[model samples]
Target: MIDPQQATPRPDAPAVEDPATMPFPLISDISAARWLLVFIIAAAIYFFHGFLVPVLAATIIAFASWPLSRSVQRALGIDRTATAALFVLVIVLFLVVPVTMALLYAFRELQQWIYWVFEVNANGAATPLWMVDLPQIGDWIDEQWMRHIGRPGAIADLVQLTSGNTIASIYRSVLAAGNVAFHLALNLLFMLIALFVFYRDGDKIAGQIDIIGARILPRRWERLSRVVPLTISATVTGMTLIAMGEGVILGIAYWIAGVPSPVTLGVITGIMALIPGGAPLCFTLVSIYLVASGSPLAGVLLFLWGAIELFIVDKTIRPVLVGGPVKMPFLPTFFGLVGGVKTMGIVGLFVGPVLMALLVAIWREWLREIRTHPQTP
Candidate 1:
């Protein structure tokens, strides 16, 4: 106490404990309990698969439209809610309305065609001369048509059989349509609900996702999350734009060639564009009809138009729609569309390519990271 500045030194301060060396809490028990809860919920969802499907579809639609919604908000200087509403409205107008109108038009055209064929059979003479000039089996088809029309009783019997089948098919189709309408209504409702929630609480949801990703896969979380949405958006936007452009061109060509029921043929062409080998099937049928109906020039022109539009327009316009920065291999993208449609119906057409692209990107990035930093054994 005589000289405080020269007092004896105290014992060294106790060494601070390193967190790396400290024992962690027994989280295994908590983790197991949490897993059990998750398993129970999964089981419930599996049991109620019907309820889950619409919810899943809603989620997918929200994801697909997220980019557009954001763009709308930025471009229009609007709030998220307004942007989402406008986005949904536009989607309904462009996608749902067009498809519904097309279906109605198709049904009307089908009925009219059936009636026209019956009238032609009842009053007209033998087969037209142009039937013999069609490409593959034109001669055989003409011969059969002449033979069948020569016998009015045979034609009547054939018409009766066809009419009966058509009626039955229409009945079945109507039932299916009723079911589809119900499901579509449910899906639309859920989708709107999901869209609202996503727009309102997207940040919170993203944060939660990031947290979960960090907990489960701390190293690759950011990369995985970004790549998934990027791949999906890029692949979907690219393929859809290409298909739509092709459809419009083919439709215009058909209209210009004076094809009977241009709208109906255009709708068919759009559907055909979604298929592999592009619009060849529709063009071939249109050409045959044109030639048989005494417009060989129109037929040739339509065929050429289809070929040129598919090859030229697709190559030229697709890159513009889907910005070239998103580079995915074309072959995989093509197969993804075809195989996805074959396996999972129409929706798969978009999903398959996105999934394949995401997987490829993830693996590539993972390999690069590993090559850059070798792990210690």
Candidate 2:
């Protein structure tokens, strides 16, 4: 017999508490907690919306280059930070430097062209020899040039036609251009910083992601994870190979056609080839220049050659290389490229295809599951 106050408690007995005196539960309901989590995630994404593109681009780049990074890390016998720095350095030297140089050269050329335009248009200037020598269309071109560009006050009239006659309009255009340049620079800086972070902490980050993914998607996470990186790598590799091939082939053609600065033009074409329709624009402009410079036959041949080559590459090589991993068809790949560019600009180039590939993969998986477990009528 024991007093109630001194009774011995069992170690496994659950403790009872007074409801009135208990502290309030922070997450009393699982459903409410889930909603709270969702709200937090949405808020975070909204806050970082501007940086999303650069971060996404960096992620794609890191995924595509991870294999090389690992090898580089091993060979150099260095830590992740040092290896990542080396990669960043290499990228700056090879990619950034060349692009910057090309841009500067283009800017200089543009300045000279603008100067010439204003100077010559100050008083009507004669049609150039090139325009006057453009074969069957030469006379028509000359007539038009004399009527529009070869007369005093032509520049003003053209400016008015372009809605650039007013000082305010021109000032606005300049401001817009400057704004674009500033945004581009800002984006680049952010991308570099994000890239460095991704490279440095990639392993730890991957492991954490894997743990979370496994918990969330226990069945499909493995396949999904494998598919994403492979898809990105294949798409990037295919783009790079195609761009280089187009550049080399077109560069050789340019030399044969006696196009000035063939090497430089080829490099430019290669860069342009990364964007949809950019390569075509390059060759088309070159062909027009050739015709204007009295090389009509060469221009015609080059244009035809480019068309044929481009067709072959697009219809055959692109689908095979870019879609091989995910078994994506040509139409899907084409749509992916176009849609990606339309939706997300340059970064979409990789992301669009990856998404398409994932969609195809999931579709196939569903088909397989259906086959394995037939529905009863």
Candidate 3:
């Protein structure tokens, strides 16, 4: 006689294995196809590493300029494709042409400076009137000037003294320059092409990215979409405008202070201003040169002007423009700048701060989640 509770046995139920009693050996879940796919991707990246910079540059530029492009497209009743093409061409003029012209002008200025050196060497240059008026070390400077640079052929003698392997060094420098130039041109060509594509199809691409983001990070995707583009645009535009302003102001100062090659110096100063502490360094060095050359009033005024102007911009304007929208702190900002420069060269300068901003945002969001729903031990 069977008990009613123990009588039924289901034929459809399969045997379940407990980990403690499993009999079969474990096999890899990742198949041969996955391994082959990864290998191919890695090999492709290695082959195309040089092209990555330009592609990245194009993406960043496209992202930063998107708003303006949209505005122009709307105002002019132009298609995205035409606007993108025009925008890229404008970028070429803005970036490439100015740089090319600056180099050309600087080269000419450099030749002039060199010729001035030769002229000074031949004419037996003397101490200037202003140097004689300097207070404490004027006498020493005057004496040194008289001894070293005041005599004819002093520069020529100095040049001759340091002429070992000159031709070989020049040859090496020329070869290196040529190689660098060729690579740079290739990168520029790729960047322009990428820029045009991004301009034309950026919205479609962005929509796809949003779809992916929603799939992966549903909770955070909306916040990210709002944050990243604004931050990128602010950082790029702010830095560029400020740097140009610094250069123009300082260049005018250089001209007023009787500094030779003021335009060239201004362009160099503007470019340097994009880097932290770079503008001050340029102004300080110029001031020191002016003072050393017996132009005390000019040097003093130039230094004062630079110190005041840069202080205003750095303390008040820059943070408001760059650090305001993202609310990123000073530490991450600095780290981003230094790290980006170390890793990616000039482009990193703009890209780094944005990355740091994104990182900081993500970290804070994660912390918030942990706080709201603390995990049980």
Candidate 4:
């Protein structure tokens, strides 16, 4: 019933628009705009979660290997793109190929071990002498073995009593292994793809990073840049070399101690040494195997040797390599190593320490700025 003129005559009143169709209405408020931008970015990241690990891996590889790429570029008088492609090819051929081969070997060994277990279960492995020689638990171990595995149908009975579905459990474990292998292959594929891209565009990306970094942290940009590359190189090179050394040393010990699959165990130990506490675990398990097999003195000596080696490396070699004055604080280093592993697995070891180093560097620089700034009059 309202007149059209009267309804349209309110010129003195402020104009209002429908919220749904108003283009970028939130952009009018800077805080809201910033939050929206952040939301958009977060949403994008969440959407691409599948690629995140590969992205992280590629970035780490790119940053860590940039110097080599540049050197090759300069030496060969080739373009950056060519150099990057070459670097990627080299990485795949040299690094990934070797790792893949090692994995295959490890997998074959695992299959053999599993088959051995099955064979032993079917044919009843003889109880080791150590089980009868223990001071307190020897009798218990012997009894348990005799009750569960020494008899013909004992294992099946024990497994039935413990869990009604042995086949199902084994099936699930096999499926899990398959899933892990598939995911690993997928991630590696993404990593190589991303790595090639990063290597090619790394200079442009670095420039952009420099710009953003300088804008946000003008005073610390130069130092941060220098520190980051050094930290990456040091952490990667140091950790890798030390792990190799530990592996070689431990492998020799394993051989001398007559451990089965000494070479395989050594490779596993070296890889494990990349993670904190991993090396200790590797050697501990081996020692336990020795102890369970009745070589108590050998077990004790091997455990002691491994413990001492780990201690020496951690105290002396690790500190010198990863903890220079300009490098990371211990707490950050620890967190980085732990959190990286938790979140990203093996490659995280290198990524974690370098990221921690960057964070520590930023923190230190910030504190320095605060301390050196002029006081108000």
TM-score for each prediction?
Answer: 0.68, 0.68, 0.68, 0.69
Task: Pick the winner on TM-score between candidates 3 and 4.
Answer: 4
lDDT by residue for model 2 (279-352), tens: 89999999999987889999999999899999998888877866642345766666766787687665565566
Residue range 1-377, candidate 4, lDDT tens digits: 99887776566888788899878753468788779889999999999988888888788778777887888888899986788789989989977777677666767767776666566567777667866877788889888888888766566667678888673476468557867778778988999989988888888888999998998889778877887776666666666657767887998899888898787898889867765666899999999889878788999999999999988887777778656423335567678778887887766665676677667766776787678885677
- Measured by C-alpha RMSD in angstroms, how accurate is candidate 4? 7.8
What is the lDDT for 112 in model 2?
62
Taken over the whole model, the C-alpha lDDT of each candidate is 0.69, 0.77, 0.79, 0.77
Segments in model 1 whose C-alpha atoms lie over 4 Å from true places: 1-31, 51-61, 64-68, 74-77, 111-129, 142-171, 325-377
Best model number under lDDT: 3
lDDT of 1 by residue, 1-377 (tens): 46988886678867778999989876787898999989999999889765544454445556666777777788889887787677667767887677667667766776677565556556645666666666788778877886666444555656457675543455467557757666656756765677677766676887998998989999889778887776666655665546655666777788899987776777666655554554788888888789778888999989888888766755766667565535566576667667766754444544566667777788888998899988989
**Model 1, position 138: C-alpha lDDT score:** 75
The residue pairs found clashing in candidate 4 are none
Residue 363 error for model 4, in Å? Answer: 5.3
Name the lDDT value of residue 186 in candidate 1: 72
Q: So what's the TM-score on candidate 3?
A: 0.68
Tell me the spans in candidate 3 whose CA falls farther than 4 Å from its real position. Answer: 1-37, 107-171, 311-377
The 10 consecutive residues of candidate 4 with the worst lDDT sum are 321-330
Worst 10 residues of 1 by lDDT: 50-59
- lDDT tens per residue, model 3, 299-347: 9999999999998987888777766433456678778778877877655
